[model samples]
Target: MSRIQCPRCQRPQSHCLCPLIPCLDSRTRVLLLQHPSEVNHALNTARLAALGLNNAELIVGEVFEDLPRLLNQPGYRARLLFPADDAQPIQTYGASDEPLLLVVPDGTWRKARKILHLNPLLAALPRVTLADGGVSRYRLRKAPGPGALSTVEAIVQALQVLEAPVSFEPLLRPFEALIEGQIAAMGEETFRRNHAGK
Candidate 1:
């Protein structure tokens, strides 16, 4: 027997996350360049982020052949959301008229690096970084270093900086629920032991 999937959020019907997502329209357009490997991860958050946003798009692949045309599209300025040493800190767009096209690469660090290495257009684009985002709320995955954040967390903080804090609050509403659900599944004892000293 096959497991049925939710057409909108693309999770197993029983595990469908659509109901947890909120509809949000954002001034900054999000374009997720996801590595093919991340498409089916059970904990994938990019899909949720895209689903919750009215102005987001997700494209899965290792190499984006249509990047040239995508970056050249009118009405928005394309910017890569990678923290290169020279990358600029994000602004709230308070003084700019152009729409922000945030191009985020979604994958593990290795895969994300490969995406950047293989995509020249992405490498050449102006890069931006989040300077002071607090700890990641995603406890499911271990980050590579201190201050590292999950893709959803990074996007949320970026949105908070690029738009209003309230504008991105809904984007994370479901994320909190998902975490709580996981903890609940683990039950109080296991959860307590895991979080005992934290």
Candidate 2:
């Protein structure tokens, strides 16, 4: 049997394309507040998103404990990148904004609820949700709806929204290569079998 691990989480190198992690160069900083449970999961997109951004920080813990300090970090105009629900619209940052995009990746619905229940600090920061509808690239995890987006995609969208000229295409390219590596390591049948049920 081939011994490979998921590229993203590096868990025994399963059929995970996470190793195809992308690196991005942008002015806007990204801070990923990941749930501790997702740290090693093959399908966790927050980890992948962190790899893509140059100014990104991945903190694994409960949101309440982990996010406040990062927000208090020097020189970051922090904003929570959640969905643009009717109840909350995108709060605008200044033209000369020192932007920080805080991404919560425990899946969309769970993340939304997490912020609602645990993150009082997050509420105080500017909130910006995506209005342009799209689907998530994280096939291993199910989204809350059709418009739900993956962490990487969400970052790309956020960058675009800020008019930052960061190249997201390069970030996506590695994902396919990683997927191919995963398939090669696991054999197509086994890989498909394992992922199909999820």
Give the best candidate by TM-score: 1
TM-score for each of the candidates: 0.91, 0.71
Tally clashing residue pairs in candidate 2. Answer: 12
lDDT of 1 by residue, 1-198 (tens): 989988887777877777779888888899999999999887678888898888999999989999998787689999999888889999878665797899999999899999999998898999999976368887755667777887888898899888865568777877777777777778978977776435
Candidate 2, superposed: residue stretches over 4 Å from native: 1-19, 63-66, 84-95, 101-105, 139-142, 177-198
- lDDT of model 2 at residue 18? 46
**Full-model lDDT for every candidate:** 0.84, 0.62
